[model samples]
Structures are given as structure tokens and as C-alpha cells.
Target chain A: MFDQSNHLPALPGVGYKPQHYSDLLADPAPVGWLEIHAENYMGAGGRPIAQLKYLAERFPISVHGVGLSIGGECDLDPDHLARLEHLCDWLNPASFSEHLAWSTHESAFLNDLLPLPYTEATLNRVCAHIDQLQDVIGRRMLLENPSSYLAFDESTYEEPAFLAEVSKRTGCGLLLDVNNIFVSATNLNYDPRAYVDAFPLDKVGEIHLGGHDEDEDDHGAPLLIDSHGREVADPVWTLLDYTLARSGPLPTLIEWDTDVPEWPLLAAEARRAQTALAQLDSKVTA
Target chain B: MSQSAFNAALLNPTANRPNGLSDAGGRPAGKRFDVYRNNVTVSLREALETGFPATARLLGEQNFNTIATGYLRANPPSSPLMMLYGGGFPRYISAIPALAKLAYLRDVARLEYAMRQSYHAEDAPALDPARLASLPPEALNNARLTFAAATQLVLTPWPIHAIRAKALGESGENPPAHAQPTLVTRPEFDPILTPLPADQGDLCGALMAGKTLAEASTLHPAADLGQLLGTLLASQALTDIHVEERT
Candidate 1:
């Protein structure tokens, strides 16, 4: 009874942190929907679940999983998959997505979105995991691009190519994290626009913009950490315009996870995103 | 490199950033690797602090950081549900020698953990007190109380309730040295810690162990069954009551 299209409105949304619960409801203004970290709401009940239920009625929630470890060598945890099924069965969110990075090694959950080495073997494992996830959740899922600080010697495929092939194989969609594009591009010495140009824009279901921390890697090159703690960076915003120009407008989320600011600040960010989406809507119609 | 090797090095900041990792250039990636190390430890440390705020306050911020760092390394979360992380932390603090000076610290951690657990515990509709009131005294004596999923009883020798209250700046009195059993009850969304006297704690414990009201009341002569029941009712701790019929 729960199978339905996994689509979020092509507009601005924000990652729902508990701190913003009251303000998000009070005056969300231009936020088209909300996205929740699946791990945070996995609890059986309480304020988290209560708030989700109430908000789900009013907004299209996108369940974003941060700990699925889709790229892990170990087989996907059946219990974790079951939790996802339960959440989907209940929330039946407008969209569901997890990262291309793995966060677990065996039973230990590292709780960080660790990078993956792009290879045929890794592709096979990720596709298998996505297949299992879709099968169990009974919904198409979106695989998100990771923000990388370093490259793996073992990787054979470019990041965009690997993502496209995974989507093609698993029939899953892609979530283009725009900030990650800029972060990875800067850290790895590539053009963010070119990465967007090579991306399979047709497959992108969601777009994400979040804050990154600036640091220097071993050789004094810029290293951008996907901190998600501050306002969306300016260059990352430019990349979003580039992506939206190509993707033509998608459900763009302003993700502020750590040190989440007051709601008005986040709402302002959402308003900016809304303007971008509104402009695209007019262009597509024009 | 193997994920196991990566995992081993990720948790141990002291471990050599190790060879075989790299930046975009072929240069060895020691600093690039520390980004992951910093992310893992720092993020998990913050999570631990959130899960045990009272404990964090009881042990000063620096001491809590030291213990949390040690506890996190010894017991990284087994599941992705960070809300459920630090289940073993109370026991972890008990074994630390440096914290041994703080006799109440372990139980305080346990109390804080229980509060967090109860905060996220399943919501259940409280049993209407009128039902119990309507029952005849004899039948009520035979009745078995079913506690709400969000209710927890943590028995500790330290006055954890007073300590938490003082930590929260709700009171100024240094908690008198006495055994306190904290009853964690979520009347709404926030879990409330109520210190129960020994007799009342035993009475609640008995009810939790499937003892009937009469049987539970018998365990503690000093327990004010009426007042205790009133407190539970006010907290919405009881979800249902099944009074046995003579058969």
C-alpha cells in the first residue's frame, strides 16, 4: 500500500535538526519541504518521531540516510535495512537518499561519511547494496556524491562516471551535493563546472548545499571538510546555479547539521535557494 | 588499504597516519588522513556529550572530554543510531581510576543515560486514573501496573536527582549524602528525574517485577502507596492496570 513515486518538489528545503523544529514550523517561509537524517528518527517514538509525524502532514520529507554504508565491503546490515523499511512504510517520504561513501567497517559504525575508491569491484558492491535497499524499502533511492579530501590510487573511474554507471545499473537516482562538487574539485585540483558538465543531470533527484571548513592538506593545498556547520559558501552557491542551470531545478536542500543557526538564518538561505528555483521555473516555462 | 586497517587508524590518533594513502598528487596522505581522524573523534565526542549532559556537568567539561575520548575509543558505536550510542558508557566510567575520586560519577552517567533513553522511548497513552479509582480496594490491591515505555527506574546510592538539579542550577544545596532511586518519567517530551525514597523505590521495583499492588506494597511498609500511585499517575507513568478477578 506504500509504493509511490519517490519525488520531492523541485524547490528549496532544509535539513531538519531538532533545534530548528519550533522555528521551522513557526515561519518556514520559502522552504518547500524538509529532509531528516534517517538515523536520528530511528527511535521508536518521542519528540523526534512526534515532530516528524506532525511535519510529514504539512511538508514533503526526504529521508536522508547517513549511515547505510552502501560502499562497505561487508554485506549490508539486514537489521539496518529493516529499520529503513519500517521508516519508509510509515513516513513514505517524498524522497530517500544515502551517500556514495561508506561509514562502517564491519560492525563498527564510524559515523563519518568516508570516501570510496571508485573501481569495478566497488561499483558492483554499491550497486548490489542499492538494489537490496530499493528491494526492501520498495522505493527508488537516490545515491549522493561524497565530498572528497583525497583520491585513492586504486580508483579507475572518475567520480562522475562511477556515479552515472551506478545509477544506470541500479536504476537509482542521484543527489548532487553542490558544495561537495566545489570541495572535491578544489581539493583534488579539478573544475567543479566540468564535473557538473559530465554529470548525468537527467538522473539527479535532489541537490544539496551545505557549509564546508577550509583547511590545508599535507602539501599545503586547500582541503575542504564537509562540516555542514555554517552558511552555504559563496563559490558553492555559484556551483548550485551552474547545476540548476543544467539540471533545470531540483529539490535543493540547505543542509546545516552542526552548530545549526537560528531558523531565520536558515530561512534566509532557503529563500535564496527558492529564488534560484523560481528563476529556473520561469526559464523552463519561458 | 583494508577497511579494518583504516578503522584501526581512524580511532587511534596516535597511530601513524600510515602509508599507501595519498592526496591527488602521489605524496603520502598523512594530513589528509587526519581529517578523517578529526572528523570521527570530534563528531563522536560531541554525540557522547549530548547523550550524557548531566554526566558532563558532574565531571567538569575537561574531565568529561577525557573520559568521553577514552570511552569512545574503547567502545565505538556498534549501530548508526547515535541516540543509542554510549549504552556501555556508564560501566566504562565506573572502571576509570582517575574518575574513581568522584564516587557518584558512574551512577550519574547511568542516570543521564536513562533519561536520554526514556526521552526517546515509545509514547504510550497513560491509563486513566479514574479506572483505578473506580476499582474496589480489594481488586485494586490485586491489580498489576503496566508502566509507560518511557518510564525508567534507576537505583543508585548517590543523590543523582539533586546532583542533576544542582548541575542544571535549579537548586543550590549540596546534595545530602543519601541513596536515591531516580524515576525517569516522560510526562510530555522531556524526561523528568524524580528522586524516590528507598521504600517507594522498592515498591515501584516490585511492581516492575510483576508483583501486584498488594504484594508490592507488602515489600515496603514505609512506602506511602497512595502518594506513590498519585505521583505515577501525575507523571503518566502507568499505561494500564489489570486487576485480577477471583477465579
Candidate 2:
């Protein structure tokens, strides 16, 4: 097992891409740490795991899960939970996080981070899943809020309140994805700032900043899609600054999954995040 | 709404929206459900495209998308791991009536699947060539070799290697009308495909079936045994060898 004491620094990191493995190992720039999709590295043995072994030794790794489907309807899949346990046992990353969304139902695994109605029933289901996940992995995982294009009228609780109650119940931390908040707010016509203010900042252990695409909703309102395919948008950066001002410089990640640019471009995004963290530090010192 | 009913509607767009599903403003949730449906289908299609690039090229993007939708509806992913998402795709392609005319399409899909398997297969140290050379001449015939986990053999009736090469832009010319047995091995990090002769393929097949060198050589009498052994060694495909003594 890796040393769990070495936590990820409250600095900037990027989602690790296999294509950039050699480049990262060669230069390894000033990037603080690395994050990877947990499912991508769940294979038996291969380059992904091998590269992770090398990188895990040098940096504080973050295992961001995409397939846990924690908010799914049925009981959490035991097989999937076992896979997660095996991976966590081996890597023992500095932090582990998963989405507040569900992707599996009736044995059909949808590849998207889907939205769920924020009702008391959903809160109970999500809490149960998180409890099982934490028990299986033996770690306090962080749950990230989802970006949705629509809301359910059946939802009895607001998204922030639902997440806050979940954290309070499950004793798990939160991963405040600033871009998701912005996207959901724009799509739902809510104040992103208000959403952040209502967010349980004290429970936030990490922060995410990613790119989004602009599309019109059914009502012709501006809809922000959490695309994660390009550089972090300027507004998202400003939002990150806003989030960090309250969260006090949580470990930030610059995520670029699709249309992955060259190394320098991604590293520059992380540098921008680092700039935000540095600004916060400077403010504290001043 | 019941969880099962909601998931069914989410996965199948044509299904009627579940009861009690309304937007925050109390409007019908058709548009919101459509967005989620689009996300699910698009992401699954992209996963299929990534897994079967050659098949996608052969079928064309539009045609592949149609087939992918059918496959997705028929065989939803059993696991959350995207790397393991398209396990039934090759079989699905083979069973399609329209794809029957393209007999080799399924093989090409298999080749792509094999390459992915080799890419993620377990890693092991290659058996030193010196060990084989040092074996006594009398013991050489009884030596059973163990291959690296990343080594895979695909004996196909189609020129899958050539077709894959052409599809990947590695070759500009069309594939020849001859069957080719391909060997996939990841000696280092990246997996490589090598087309083998008929006799060599038979010999490898025999060896993989637990036949010793002498038995495997006999199975392909006309094969150049020295060349076969040399190629296997050079590719670092053999991981272990043991001599079986006969009384």
C-alpha cells in the first residue's frame, strides 16, 4: 500500500492522459500532481497501470471515479465495488472522488454522468451507495455535484441542500466542481454565485475546473455543456477564483478529456489554476 | 417515478416519459430527458468507435452509428468500465444480416478487439533466448514454452492484418484476397501485429495448445521451425519454458 499520509498539495494538477505519458515523464514540468479516471486504470496490467506506478511514486495521485454510479437506483454493484477496492488497495491514492450522478440502472451501464431528482428518496439512495462505497474502499471519498440540463419537478430539495445533507449524513467530503456549478446554474437559470455561497465549503476537499460548451436550452436560454474538451473558459477561471476565496485553496484540477491539446497547453491551464491558488496565498499573507 | 421505469425511458428515447417527471417549473420533462438520452447514446457510440476503429471505417460513420444504436439497445454495457464496454460488439456485427455480405467485417472487429486485449494484457519478462539455446538437444523436443500474456493469435479467413493496416492509414493499397493469420504481441509498451504464413500459424496454434517443440514441429512439417522459433524469441513472446521428460 502507498503512503496515505502524503496528501495532494493545495496546488494545481491536470487529468493525466496516456498519450502524454512519455512527455510527462520526460519533462514533468512544475505541475503539482495528477488525476486519472478510476475506470481507465482498472485493467489487470498494462501501460496505464505501469505509468501510474511510475507517476504514483513521484506525485500525489487523485483517483476520480466515473463508473461507480453512486446515485443509481438499485444497490451498488458489488463487482464494481470490488474492482474499486482492489484499485484503491493497490494505488492508495492521496484522494478518491466520484460524481454525485448515477450511470447504471437495470444492468445497463450508461457512460454519462446522469442527473437525479434531489428528493428525500434520492438522498437516502445516494447515502446508502456512498456508505457502501466508503466501506468497501475504506476511505472518505469526495462526491462531486453534477451539471444537468434539466431539473425534475418531483425534486423536493435543492441540489446544494441535497449535497450538504448527503455530506452531513455519510461523513464524506465534497469536490466542488466550479464549472459544473456554472453550467448547471446557467442551464437552470440560477445564480452560480448563490449556489457557491450555499455550498458547504468547509466540507470541500478538492476543486475542479473544466471547459464547457455553449448551447441553447429548450427555452432558448444559454445552456452550458460540461464538455471538458478545451481549455478552461475565462468565466470558469473567475469562478474558480471566487470558489477558492471561500474554500481557501483546495487542491485544484484542470480537466481536459477530449480534444486533448499539447502538453504545454494543458500545463499552462494548470499554471493558471496555480495562479489562482497563489493569489489566494498572497491575499492571506497580506 | 420508479427507478427502473426512469432508467428504461432514459436508455430508450422512444419510451414514454415516466409519471411524475416534470421540470423544475412543473413543465413536462421531455426536453430534459432528450438531453440525457442524447448524452447516453453519444457517449456509448463514441466508446464503440474507439474500441472498433477499423469496423467503424469499413461501415462508414453513418452506417456504423446506426449499427451502434441497435447494438447499444440490444446489448447494453454489462460493466461500468468503458475499456470493457464493447465485449459483444464483434459477435453483434457477425450476427447482423446486412453485414453478411461483408464476411470479413467481423474478423476485422475481432482483430481490433485483440489489439485492445493485448494492449491491456498482463506484463511479464520475456524468457531469455540463451535459455532455449542452452537446452540440451535431446531436451529441446520436449520443451513446452509459455507465452507472454500480451501475446495473442488470431487465425482468420480474412486478411485482417492488411485490412486493419489499410483502414488505419498505414497502407494506401487495398488488402489482398488471401487469408492471413496474425500474431499480436506487446513486447514493450505498444502492441504490434504481424501476419504469419499458414504453416507458421499452425505451428503456433499447436504450441499454444500445449504441444512441445517436437510435437508442434510435426504438426506443421513443412514449416521452417528455426524461423518460427527465431521469430517468437525475437518478438519476446515466450515467457517461460519447461522440459517434459518421457520415460
lDDT (tens digit, per residue) of candidate 2 on B44-131: 8998999999899999999999999989977879898888878789889999898899989988888888888988888899999999
Per-residue lDDT of B205 in model 1: 88
Off by over 4 Å in 1: A1-6, A282-286
Evaluated at residue B209, the lDDT of candidate 2 is 85
Per-prediction share of native contacts kept: 0.80, 0.73
Put down candidate 1 lDDT per residue, B1-247, tens digits, no spaces. Answer: 7677788899987887655777877888778888889889988999999888878888889988988998888889999999999999988988888768887888888888888889889999998989999999999999999999999998877888888788878899899778789899998999987888877888898898889999988888789999899989998998999989889
DockQ for each candidate?
0.80, 0.67
Docking outcome class, model 2: medium
Each prediction's TM-score against the native?
Answer: 0.97, 0.95
Candidate 2: which pairs clash?
none
- Model 1 chain B: weakest 10-residue lDDT segment is B16-25
